[model samples]
Target: MIAKSNEARCTSCHAGYGWKGNDFDFTDQTGVDCLVCHEQTGTYKKFPAGAGNPAPREMVFPGNGKTYHPPDWNKVAQSVGRPTRNNCGTCHFFGGGGDGVKHGDLDSSLMKPNKMLDVHMGTDGQNFDCVRCHSTTLHNIAGRVYTTPAYEHRKSLIEDDLASKITCESCHSSSPHKEDAKANDHTDKVACQSCHVPRFARVNPTKMWWDWSQAGKKKNGKPYKVKGELERPEYDTLKGDMKWAKDVVPEYYWYNGSIEHLTVKDVIDPGKDVVINRPVGDKDDIHSRIFPFKVHRGKQPYDKVNKTLVVPHLFPKGPADADAYWKTFDWGKAIAFGMDYTGLPYSGEYDFVETSYVFPITHMVAPKDNVVACKECHAHEGGRLAKLTGFYMPGRDNFRALDTLGWIVVIGALLGVVLHGLGRVFTANGRKEQ
Candidate 1:
């Protein structure tokens, strides 16, 4: 789907080369140009100094030469993220036919964006305006925007560890792989995209919800339909079967609040009950960094599951055991059992999942151990004494438990020393009497 921006507008990145359709213009500074987005546009100028050198490819301006950099190259021009009220709203302002509030209803801005009718999601809270966070602009356009550290999605990703493909291995290798007859050894494997590369931009952070009303057997993940409208992938399933999705999975109700959808419904358990409890589009995910790119948190080689993150599970209303569905899980056990439960099937040395399916699509080099870093190491710490309880959900505090254990150990050691001292005194008295 198109962004919530003006259709005739030009892209911030591709300056002179191209624009969406035929809307791009070289001299159209009134709309968009290389300098329109790239240049550190201060008060709108004809040009800046250092006209001889050109800017770097990441931030190429229309006319200005590259900004001179120091020896370290750390001073690379930082590109702004979100649009500023002045930068974007100017075109979308009054006389231009923009929403009078800059981020409000569409009235008169240059040309209004087509996405959101109202900018902010708040219905009752303080009405947020463009100038709230983005108070300044380079070319009267703000550079970056504020974001949440964590996510706010409908589907609880705790159980969908198999779906997240942050690392190279996940997409590259399929699970339940039994290469050898004995199924004990696996040494070799390949990256995922080797075979299942994408025709379109099938990148990270996919939507994980399905509309049950629009779902069926083939669409419900029934025995991998190859040639029906109910195919799983819908457009691209495996490498050679890219055409299978249209035939296999028809009427796929996947929508990321936009088109080019990716979905997984029956979220309560991959569609046992027909009603959908989770819909990805309903999520309001906020990223600590550049969204999907910052998949891992805490450290490198982190738990890919935690990296994907999720909202607290919402119990189904219609389902019989809706309460059971909402039952708090042994979050630690869930992860530990996941690891200890299903070790990767290696081919004496090579993995069959990596060899046959997952690796080709992911284009990832299969992990040697096939073990999740966070699951194995974090067992007793936050893993053991965890909880997801109440309407205002909060995870259990395991650190406090550890501290209590530490005090117990310390007191136990002191008691042992006191007992030893008493025993020595008793022994000395007995020897003296003798």
Candidate 2:
């Protein structure tokens, strides 16, 4: 999707200033906007379409209708401090267009959460900042996306000197439950987030489904928007049909930290569901554990002849642009432009193909009282872990032969006990006569 986006629109949240093209210098430390992360002043704002530049003068952005004011350089410089929740949330909460859009576990609600919402980030509870877990070294933050391994070895801070402090195991050791050995034992097979964070999008609704095939529908002369069940725009002329949900029960998967992704040029089967990325592990893998994920399903364009996914130019450069899907609403022109930009060949004929992308749920740490109960995943029917097979869960799995043998053993033991008691009673009379 980065290929479909304009740098001006996409890089405002991530890339520092003047990163409009490939020629942008990556080694220049001066270009790095330290104020964006370190400034204590809440006034520091990046222009939405400024390609990582702040507003030169006071002006409103035409895209989002938000007014931007040039920061007072002296005031901001004096207020330089460690990054706060607001500093990190400024970019992360707004990723993928708006708040709670990209990541269901992260949103503006976390900024001032209560203990019930998040035990760590809650202002009324532990009140831990983002840096508390995501320790930084030379500005290379500790956390990595699920597509890559965050830690080579899983160990607590006291266990190893080289272990990453980002993992939950780093702080809360492998055996965190003090009294419950059963729960502590489950840690080996289940991820901490899988049980600790039972559901995601607990506070705000997140987009669960998107259909790009339904895009380009416009009202007479101008593009229009329609609100859906969540009171948010479900159908947009630019994007398409979207379905939103809150308090979402996450889909479970066996993840070993690393993942495999489908590249833009990779061949895909049009008949099957195109997985954007998949976790790389199985039940047998030693490092793998049952992790929770928010699966976002969608339908997007793919070349029928080339048998590859096509990236459409989605953001418009300006009002006069014709190829961008936002402005022109022409899939052919947008796909052609985006493909040319990426130096990939695209067949003239294109059709929509189903796709699925997953985001790991790692945030929204609930209190101990709110943790998922044992029966949620260990019950005989409709369990959270019903889809997971090959493992013999104590209460959930049953074998007919094993049950029959167990019952026979119990019956034989009871019969032997009764016969021994009867024999002892019969011998009591003879012993008295002797």
Candidate 3:
């Protein structure tokens, strides 16, 4: 199941490499094609149907009685230079098959962005690239995955260093706000991205929901799809029903830089929505901070008999693969093939259950001037952090005793000032009459 899906879905972005065979063997040096990243020629293309390899020009127009000439490999090699945002955007920006499908923070708009869109990558600002923050060394990147971070602190590079040194603090420092002490104090309880990002999918809509239970719906014996607003697919026979949103405010959560992922082996309760992945943190933890996240909700397949999530073979490598879900639209066949491929047991019973996965919003950092204001989260009611507990925000959270004491102090001060003014005015009038 994994192999078949990789051959179809994974290859969409992992293409242009020389990957071979069905298994994921890192020893297969053939898969690592340097030209995919270094080649400056836009003519370089990859075959999405193949396993991340450049498609033969003939395959594009097969048997047309025309001999299609290949691109000049020598010229492309000579033109190779540093990778640009376009090279990285080819995979990162279009993560889950389409533009703004996975990460709300990333999209094609980052390419040649202006200062209004992003402060770092803006053409009018710093104009920094991905490598600037995600610095790499010896092919090991400095950034962490969305679910986990190897390191959250800046450290010197050394052998056997497992922690990642790349972080917003590496440049911004712990005290980012120089003028505002109040803003600087928030660093301990709030993440840099929480206020800076404000919102995600600012330029494009991101996939907010996926309902696999609705898949395999066909009309007139043909797979059907419905288009939604902004040219996004509302429903598809292959995937399922989807919901998308733009300029979305992120869900706030306290994150301590740890995560728990629901693996294939974990048994889940059928009654509740299973969390596919979530950050492990709380308001009480010292290391934790209020962070912004994109909570992606979906309905995915699970083994009704075994009570565990099942990975289905959604894509097929060839036309003859009947077990492929997209090709056959048969859940039973797809689940069976998937379980057998993964060497897991199947009880022949499958059902769809609601699930959710959380993705941290770290990109699309707006300019300092455009950050979330204090009142957004510090209001008396309906604040952004109103749902967050364990800490007492000045205006948001209230204690009865503290409020009474504060009112008493204020009234006492006001009465004293009024009495002193009245006494002075009466004494002056008496002196004038005398």
Top model number, lDDT: 2
Model 2, residue 392: C-alpha shift (Å): 1.7
Query: How far is each candidate from the true structure, as Cα RMSD in Å?
Result: 25.7, 5.0, 5.4
**Per-candidate TM vs. native?**
0.21, 0.90, 0.85
Model 2 TM-score? 0.90
User: Could you tell me the lDDT of residue 115 within candidate 3?
Assistant: 75
Off by over 4 Å in 1: 1-27, 31-121, 136-139, 145-419, 422-434
Q: Write the per-residue lDDT of candidate 1 for residues 1-434, one digit (tens) a residue.
A: 11111122223322333333334454665443433323333332221211212223234232224333322122223433344444433333421111221111222321322112222312233233444423343444332212221112222224454333233223233332466522122212211222122111111111122121111233354323243343223221111122111101001111122212211210122212222111122122221110011010011011222221111112222235222112222222222322322242111211001000000011111123332232322254453112211212123334678789999999999999999889889898478777
Which residue segments of model 2 deviate by more than 4 Å?
3-5, 25-31, 400-434
* Model 3 Cα lDDT, one tens digit per residue, 1-434: 13444454576455424454446664655556677677888656555554565556645522123343445788878879777787788778888767888888888888878877788899899998877777777766666664565466534344224434466776666776887778889888898999999899888889999998998899899888899996789998888999999999999998887777888889999899899888878888778888999998999889999999897988775779999887899999999988887778899999899999888898888999999999999898889888887778888888889889999999999999899889879898478778
After superposition, the stretches of candidate 3 with alpha carbons farther than 4 Å from their true spots are 1-4, 12-20, 27-30, 58-71, 146-150, 154-165, 400-434
Task: Count backbone overlaps in model 3.
Answer: 0
Clashing pairs in 3: none
Model 2, 167-218: lDDT tens digits are 8999888999987778889888899999999899888788888899999898
- Candidate 2 at 8: error in angstroms? 0.9
**Which of the two, 2 or 3, has more lDDT?**
2
